[model samples]
Target: MPGAPFLRGDRVDLRTVTPEDYDFLLEHGNDPAIRHGAPAPTPVTREDLANFVEDDDESVQFLACHGETPVGFVFLFDVDPWRDHAELGCWIAPNEQGEGYATEAAALCLDHAFGDRGLHKVVARVFEHNDASMAVLDKLGFQQEGRLREQDYVRGQHHDTLLFGLLAEEFEV
Candidate 1:
């Protein structure tokens, strides 16, 4: 469990990551299904996750939960208060996928980004092979901006990264 959820959605709640959440991330974050689109160079250890939650200040991260059970996490990276933009990243636990948890969590975060954070735009980069992630972005009204051909080499194969963006004026929430 987290200290207290900073935001809540229909199906999920967003909380700042806690040390206790590291084990959950270790188990689910390393799943091949979850890591396929978002590559992890090596298996992440507890210490690394601890550092990420405790030390990294460049990004804002939240763990999503349905009740007391963790469902996933959402992130706003490279946030530029001056530019009024940020890069978004999110993942659903393998067991928790396909239940709209990610979508719900994303909606909550996007609301925060455009409303509370006062960001003008938010961006996302998705692996070419992750159609599900693309669908989530589409459902959230993000427009396809561009593609970086063969931008990432993961799991012994090169993959393209598709960029998507949503402006605050375009966001429904």
Candidate 2:
């Protein structure tokens, strides 16, 4: 079972990731649909996933849970404390995508980022074809700052990656 939440919201709670959650992470990492928007879509092994969970020193990762069941994950990576910014990344399970879990979970992380961490900005990247992620970023008040044309090759074709940013002052609860 997952541990208690580190950040709580109305509908979801963000909990620190644990070894028990490795299977959940592995399942999502290998799902093509889930991996579609990822910059690196290569197949991942259990050992590889374990390494990510263990060796991450520059990122803060959390599991989004609804009543103890993990529904998704949200994280701040590429954190540059000197610059007061970090990159946000998240994914919800296929069956759980339409709900508000992603938004709420991300909001909780943003709260931590801009509030507790005293960050100046948070950025996110999404593939052009990822409408869901775009919507989520939009809801979180991330402005589309720029785009990298044909930056990622997925499923045989190249797709542009949209860069979005949210200033600390621009974020809303």
Candidate 3:
């Protein structure tokens, strides 16, 4: 707990997602609140997640930790080396929300995306109704770029998908 973190932050560390962490993903990742931004419709099986962790070559993913405890996840996906861009995605456990973990992890991912990965830009698509996620992006200096009208239907309601983008030059830290 006193040593260096995998990717150190003020309040959290970002480390590679391991096979053992899939169990944690199964439990926290499927919580209804956490699923609000997830692309998949249903909870995934361990096998499905295993394949995801193994087959995913375009994304840079990390399991968020606080002193060795897994609290959430962050990812930069849909990476296009030629295009110099990627899509950002992240989530904190329901119990861990509001502690600033998501923000720090996201910022770290952006650092890796821009500093380490040398990407020109990063983008995110969030649900219109999810103000919390939108606020997180806003705090990270992402600009609202566009919106897709009623692009998602969940809980018997249609919601627009808001697109946010941040250029490498726009990154603050």
TM-scores of all predicted structures: 0.95, 0.95, 0.94
Per-residue alpha-carbon lDDT of candidate 3 for residues 1-173, written as tens digits (9 for 90 to 100): 22235588988998887787888888987888888775557778898777777797887778899888888988888999999999999999998999999889999999999999899999999998788899999999999999999888777777889999999999997
Clash tally, candidates in order:
0, 0, 0
Least accurate 10 contiguous residues by lDDT in model 3: 1-10
Q: Any runs in candidate 1 off by more than 4 Å, and if so which?
A: none
lDDT of 1 by residue, 17-117 (tens): 88888888889888888889785758889988877777777578899999888889898988999999999999999888899988889989999999999
Residue pairs clashing in model 1 are: none
Q: Residue 37, candidate 2: how far off, in angstroms?
A: 2.2
lDDT against the true structure, each candidate: 0.89, 0.89, 0.87
Per residue, candidate 2 scores C-alpha lDDT tens digits across 1-173 of 88668998998999988888988987886678888978765888877766666787778888999988999989999888999999999999888889889999999999999999999999999998899999999998999999999998878989999999999999988
Ranking by TM-score: 2, 1, 3
Instruction: Assess candidate 1 and give its lDDT.
Output: 0.89
Worst 10 residues of 2 by lDDT: 49-58
User: Pairing residues by index, what is the TM-score of model 1?
Assistant: 0.95
Look at candidate 2 and tell me the lDDT of residue 152.
88
TM-score of model number 2 = 0.95
Whose TM-score is higher: candidate 2's or candidate 3's? 2
